[model samples]
Target: MKTIQRIKNVILLLAIITLTISCNSDDNGGTIIDPEPTTISKYVVGFQAFPVGQASPAEYILDLPSLESLTTGEISVEGQGIPLRGWRFFHSAGNTVFTAGYSDDDKCIAYQLDENGALTEKANFAFQSTLDNYAALDDDTLLAVELTYGGLSDKRFHFINAKTGLLEKIVEHPIDIDMGSGTVEDPGSIPWVTGMILRDNKLFVSYHKWLADGSYITPDVDRAYVAIFQYPEMELEKIIEDDRTSPIGVNGHSTGIEKTENGDIYSFSTSALSAGFTAASKPSGILRINNGATEFDTNYFFNVEEATNGGKLFWMDYVGNGKAIARIIVDDNIGAWGVFKEQGEFFKLVVIDLINKEIKDVSGIPIHANRYTSPMFVEDGKVYLSARTGPAIGNNGENADLGETHVYIVDTETATATKGAKVLGLALKGVFKISN
Candidate 1:
């Protein structure tokens, strides 16, 4: 009796399989097969997994897909985590993404995206010490500025091979800014290197010398300064200055300036609430250099605050076709370490017309307190951004609850932003998209 029952159950299982296949076979005399995905796009975000607004365990990288079917996945370097904390800088070229630790580690890592959209460790480079400002020179090279605080002396720029993550060259530049000695009233000047541009076989590095005090004050508040160094030789050509704005770019981070489609360069200055950043010294705005010219366009000046009714320019990046997207601080009266400030509110996105010298506010971006945002990424003529509010959007938004971090997909033409994939991390260090 037991043998008969076992045989009967096996027969029933086979019959059910046969019936299911038959149902899928020729419904309405046509065959149905699932389609295959052709291309893959992703937003690679570095997750600083921590609480209390800072500090982290070993960091993780997540490759969140644009398509819904393929779930978001993490990129582990040989099954090991990448060591990143606080702010991170990234540069994307070819099918690879390059990352260097800022305000922290001395390591550089590259993740290569294959045809099937798998990010594997390509190389990991180490510096003699940690680096501050970062730039991508070309397909095979990356530039990192190792900065020291006081008066910008003995600063070094290391060029690394992107493929192998090895140091190829070094440019040692001594920045000469007259900063007072560290006393109660006069703290010396520190070279706050902001960003770099490579053109005409030379490197144009933008930075400002600021007081070493925690107030974040700029000592030389009269002119915008750019250090010109001949590439490969690393010889100082000349320091160019214009009495146009306070500083060429903001104090920290790298996206304060960029080259546009027409080979023209435009830079934005923060000129926020500080001793030298007052309106008499400089109002935050746009300044440009004509293509192949070393001097700032003397005839061109676009005062962003004057045009936008007192909105200070926080950051600007060239999106495509001579246009840029910027973040503005309207009425944020937070402190220097606003990263810990939870109640302050006022940050928005906008679009800038470089050719026409116009600034217009962008719509669809929510307002919340954001102490800082990372460098932006542009791919396929679209600007990918993280509306970085940390966790303050929760308490400040209409919902009045803790909020999560997300990236914004901006339509540059329309000046409207659409929400992208939800990022998993404390700080939205940056977003990069690798394409085939």
Candidate 2:
């Protein structure tokens, strides 16, 4: 049986696949379908596999589509049965792996991997006895922001020595504001640290500034900048402020900030604020700001109206020649395009024309009606999407709960979507390009 992680949250992640193909479709109006090309290269998918109810943690490095075979390793280094909640593969000068997770005890733990891709007991850290948000600054340095409890605030950021597992530098600022009379405090509102990215020698962090009354405040348009710093020293250099859009409020959270080759930065968040509301109550949107600007581009907001809650952009990338293709996984929207309400409730992989800012709807492609899927584009113009054979529910519901998901690869050059492979008990997560 396939091992699955029991995430207490509303949703849990599983697997991802990608292939190579064309960019156009045929007269029949579907992704071009050709035989699974032989030009494919094997990309490694490192995942955490655990059963639904058990705490026995095992790590997996699997070649997707071949569910039967797996290179199994145990995450039993420092502590036995550490629950892996999240994983990210970073860019390195040499080969290195940095993974962060919560322990079975609910404390934060960051683990390192050896050159051979095995989890190492060499570098490890227990984060302040709280659930902390962390990202790799690089191979040697790491950024860790603490999660607050009982309406209390913590540090804004910390720089840790990835090699020595020691705190190098720290940034902590306290904010005091009333939580309106009669409102209780929620510790979950702790500035949920989203993602961290590096450009030039500067570090950019996407974080929500938490408010005192148990709620959070989106950064002011002037303050809605990537919290900037320099490397190694982790000094507060300055903020990459933008003047592109007016001051709009976010729910004070965003996924990882994405950067293009042209040095443009992009970020998305699920918020509950109106464009005209105060900094604490505006709706959520995907915001884009060019480099060095202090304003949120009013034009860059993709409003998921009325729903203050939704899954985040788990992955984003530039596809197509000359950066024409853009794919983003909005785990809450479930692959629907346009300003539709139902679109924001499920997981979705949106294919957008970045230059034109147009996302292709299911009607524009060959996907079944309401058959939501997350897609990844690999080399040679290939796009891959995965869907469960039955209903659109993501959890393990009745009706083929195990191994019902299907993967389809679309060759945009040929404009065809074809069923490429099947996996038992697998749900598609994010995709990474392994080759040029």
Candidate 3:
């Protein structure tokens, strides 16, 4: 009996030891699980603009929610009363948020975003312009445009200082091109209002050459160049032109430019040669201008017929680690998104690889085609494309909701777009930028 009792005690001790070891192993091993991913916030603003003779309206402000807590399928616009319009940021202000808009009458409104995401109205100066697009310089000044009725005569640009509310018209020539010098076949009109960016004290303004039909041709003209000016003095520095062609391999036109964090200007144009306007919906290509030499980077080129061209590259918002978030027209011939085939009817947001210069279709996001304006990055490593959310019209009589704009914050970091929110019509055009 004594021997048996001793044996039982030994067994019990062994069992307890084994159980303790197992518990310890399970606790330590289970706690070594992976951590959740992190992302950066993307700031965005709606380019809300209306045509002339139309009732002017105010743009809305929106706050994009994180991919983790997206329940309502949309982000919230924290500020309800703030209004904005055709505006651009100033890299000199450390990329501070500065914008200008038009109020009823001839006044141009200026605003700055405080650290708290609140817009402080800085200046309200009277501006007379039939067409205008404004770009902020540092935190003090902006450049915009003014044109006569029907935009047939002299169209001028104004340089307005945010501090003193002073407006100065800057037009070296009454018009961008010499109307009488050459027998211009098809003159594409400059966009209603043109914009300018100041870099190294040089202002680069995009010039639009109108076509003969009065309808502004897609951006892809070699004659189209970025006019460089000396700020404050507004002296002509140089007109930077690129090698571009027209839609259907016809006339050339170039439009949008984005300065990368790496100090390179990535210029994009609508091309006639690469993809005919009607087929690809418009001309498309991205030209890299560096060292005073402009070369069309094949990787960034969008050839509509080519499998990679997607459809046509419209706008490039920013350059990421190795790619860019842009709005590109994808052909419905491939049955993408079952979207409409009409030009501008079925636009899709795309993420283009800057290194390889290849574009990947990201049109799976649930939103209207060609609706997103500013595609920005968010804190969660997600791409946020602005969506038009409302029905057709805003009570304001302005072309209110283009397509029920909403925030499609996609996390391609995970190879998926996880966060999205749909706001009503007015909320679609709301102002949205990342905080925290």
Candidate 4:
């Protein structure tokens, strides 16, 4: 009996040890199990969509691999209301994804993807009355510039610490882009900031001396300038100007300046008349701000229009190894606005060798009328082009419903494009990629 009791005690001790070990393994109120690995998303495509004719475009996201249904319009079909507010293609800097709606109830929103590929909304910033153009400063910060029409006193800069949910506002700065000396803006012209680029703690603001009254005018057509300021402190540094280009970029968009692998910052200015009538003397060209330099390099001007023998620069984004994919206005009659209002008949896609100063029109990419094209993305010496085409309209608008868009994967060496997934209903505004 004593031996049996000793055996029973040993068994009880072993049972308790087993229970404690099991409990330790599942300490966080759940069982521990290995999860199947998820594929890291290769690409995230953003679409600007509308349900019907002339509706304000909404935002949509396409998750790769399981792309059975690619359009966000299908979400509306699933009893989900598509709540879109002037949402532009999202901008990604580091780990966060961000987008904004101009003068809307929700001024901005940002999201973060978890390790398992689940996305969570990190912030939704609502403005009182001012609308802003936001640019990503980093994964944890965003810079919002409130334009003048937001009440003149609305010339405020709001910096949001996206990680900490903290915001700081700066209201005063020395801003005078017009021909005048003081902050008093030129008559019939307002300052339209195209975008902001941050470099080594300095902020470069690209802007146009816009012609108001619903018209376009370049007051001084020969030269364009960008305002440099001390970042975080928000003090004026100096205005850098170059006569090689009309404006530092196209109108109201963020593709103006690109930084290459060599850390050289290149700016493209379109000399199109619709972009405010650039001087005939100055061709649409490329200007460089050498690495770490606050001023333009006077000796480095690659005349893009001259390179194409009369083509005007439209849009440009840098690829690796001193090359860029560019859109040039190949014809003069189609003009700038006609690319939007009439049909996209004037633009041509080409490869630019920044080092060699050569421009070659990309072949195998169809040229059809499109109102807008997606902001191109570069990866591994290739560019992603998204352009939507529709039926041509006559002197009177007719048969306009024949619209379609596709994503093209291009090989820079061959200058040929192969089409990928077709998107329905909306145009692809931008493509943001995620690596596994």
Judged by TM-score, which candidate is best? 4
lDDT of 1 by residue, 1-436 (tens): 9999999999999999998788779678647887886676666765554344333333566665563311234223334445555445566555567776665677778887666877777787777656767777777777888756544366778887766666777877666555566586876666667888888788888887766664556667777888878887888898888787778765446766688767788888877662125333577778888888988999998888778533777667778777888877755354443323322345678888878777766776676443344567666656766654433334324332355545666778988877665544444556666654
After best superposition, candidate 2 residue 228: deviation in angstroms? Answer: 3.8
Lowest lDDT 10-mer window, candidate 3?
Answer: 246-255
Instruction: Kindly list the per-residue Cα lDDT of model 2 for residues 82-147, writing each as its tens digit.
Output: 334432222211122233343343323334444443444444455554434444555676666655
Write candidate 3's Cα lDDT for 1-436 as tens digits. 9999999999999999998778766965634556764433434344343323454433543233334323255343344435445332211122223343333445554444445545455455654543345455555655556543233455566666655555645664433443432345533344332345556666666655544344444333443356766766766666655445322111111125655556555655544222223323333565554433333343444343253745555456554565676655444343322332111234556676654667666645643443323324344456655544323243344444345545566554433453355544332332334322
Residue 348 in model 3: lDDT = 57
lDDT scores for all predictions? 0.66, 0.40, 0.46, 0.63
Model 4, TM vs. native: 0.78
Residues forming the 10-long window of minimal summed lDDT in candidate 2: 68-77
Clashes of 4: 0
Give the clashing residue pairs of candidate 1, or none: 151-189
RMSD of each: 12.8, 20.0, 13.5, 6.2
Give the per-residue lDDT digits (tens) of candidate 4, residues 1-436: 9999999999999999998888878758646778887756645555655445554556665444433233222312123313346645455655555565655444566655556776556666765544345566777676766555311231467677756434556455535533333333634455656667788888888776654433455566677778888977778888888876676766535667777776678888877764445344577888888889988988898987666533777777777778788777656564445555323445667888887888887876666443444446666666776666554445444544565666666777876777666765445666666533
Model 3, backbone clash pairs (residues 3+ apart or across chains), number: 52
Better of 2 and 4 by TM-score: 4
Candidate 4, residue 207: CA error in Å?
Answer: 1.6
Q: Per model, state how many residue pairs clash.
A: 1, 41, 52, 0
